[model samples]
Target: MERAQPLPSYLVHRYQGWKATGYADNQSWYRRLAELGQHPRAMVISCCDSRVHVTSIFGADQGEFFIHRNIANLVPPFAPDGDYHGTSAAIEYAVTALKVAHLIVLGHSSCGGVKGFHERCLGRAPELAEKTSFVGRWIDLLKPGYERLGGNDADIDSATLEKEAVKVSLENLLTFPFVQEAVDQDKLTLHGVWNDIGEGGLEYYDAKSKAFRPV
Candidate 1:
């Protein structure tokens, strides 16, 4: 076997230029970040997909959002056990240590993870049985949403499933002790967001409208 090649010429040149210009400021940003620590006012739970970048989509600056990214941005109910619990640990730190006031679960269009979940449930992709070993276990948190669909799984569109998964994650967030406590004390708020990749639009869950509206 052979190792992969280095980056292309254009990318290398562009990266070098960005490194030169982006870092030429009043001070080195990395040092400032280390000194200031992350004091983000809000925590955003988003997918690990490269296309759904939280900072780029929200136009957020450094230290603006304490972010946690995982497959499908799913937050499982609080459970203390042998589970790796990467997302839960980040949530604990954000809520208990950072004490962020707002927690946003951002879902985007055409999420591959959610599509994988759908396929696993529908038995279309058996190879997913091995690949989804961990992801399938995590996505079980959305079992209620699957039940809520209450129709032919084939007829359930991927977009609809993706949106429902966000709602499921929001519901699961309440299961966390720290998050529940924060919400009960009126110290934390939960938001569900849908980001449209094609149109560059953001739709937030509107309680008054009972639908997702432009944000």
Candidate 2:
């Protein structure tokens, strides 16, 4: 089958420019990274959204972060179910092997996974029920939060659901033995961050303030 769309002229020009200058600008850094291996100071768990590029957001170069991306940046409670635990396994390696000092769960505005959970819980979209797929199974992790919201169909707002989902994932992170041990032993600090793309603002979860505040 043919591709759905052709490359835009502007993007095609930019891609050509990148191909010409990228090697000169990036090759040395990549070579150094290869020689040094990764010694990232932080491990960021972010959503796998093309718009939410973690490195660009943080102004980071290659090898600056040990990164893992998943739907909604959700971290499920650790379980040995003989299934693929991609996110959990990455976290384990980042903590135990790389020994990163910080763990950041990066949530963002207009998250599809969070929105899907809200709709699923509220039963707003019955068609979603027919699509039994990975996203559906993944969002099931947020069921407790959905129940806690009292099943009031009116309370299923996207913003509220997204914020609550961040908290849920933060709590779920503690369920992992490696994460808990790291936090208890003062080896790592856990943080939840919400990026508002519309406002170009970042809100961080403050334990003392008990709310997400601008950073």
Candidate 3:
């Protein structure tokens, strides 16, 4: 095993600053959180985009939300195969162990993952179509959503497909038996949300309207 080196100077400076301010101000609260463990009320599955700050957007405090970030905030159909499924593992832990009351699939506009999937479907990104591309396979989970957008349409915009991706994930969540049980027993509620990063606007899926409404 390789020995880890010290953090970069900038990261060290930032850590020191946070320790002195954010950490010092909430010493007692932090201690209480450590002692009691976490009881977050919700789990947020979102994109790995740096611009999407999950905690800041919701004004969440420490131990308030269990979050999992991936290429496109996608959830695959329940596959019990004995393989490494990071996203599925997180979902199982959150639904069964954490028993979170709410599960949110948050997608954002201008998502690179969604765009890549779109391009690949249109035969523009042959690289992503390769079997060895990790990201290609990951975003392939969004194939269903892309098809919903009329896959062959050359003019399909990124924004439209981004929202559809959210709904696709929400649908896939139902494939997980535990998640289905929770919903059936009224113990858990599922939500699909899209964020307009540039405008700082939020939209939620309305089942009745089958459309995204501003929140």
Ten consecutive residues with minimal summed lDDT in candidate 3? Answer: 146-155
Q: Candidate 1 at 43: error in angstroms?
A: 0.8
Candidate 1 weakest lDDT stretch, 10 residues: 22-31
Q: List the residue pairs that clash in candidate 1.
A: none
Mark the regions of model 2 whose C-alpha exceeds 4 Å error after superposition.
1-16
Give the per-residue Cα lDDT of candidate 1 at 2: 79
In the range 28-85, model 2's lDDT, one tens digit per residue, is 7778888988899999999887889888788987778999999988889989798899
Query: Model 3: per-residue lDDT, tens digit, 12-121?
Result: 99999999999999999999999999999999999999999999999998899999999989999999999999999999999999999999999999899998888888
Stretches of candidate 1 off by over 4 Å are: 1-15, 26-30, 130-132, 151-154, 208-210
Candidate that scores best on TM-score: 3
TM-scores for all predictions? 0.87, 0.87, 0.97
**Candidate 2 clashes between residue pairs 3 or more apart in a chain or in different chains:** none
C-alpha RMSD in Å of predicted model 2 compared with the true structure: 3.2
Clashing pairs in 3: none
Better of 2 and 3 by TM-score: 3
Error of 3 at 103 (Å): 0.2
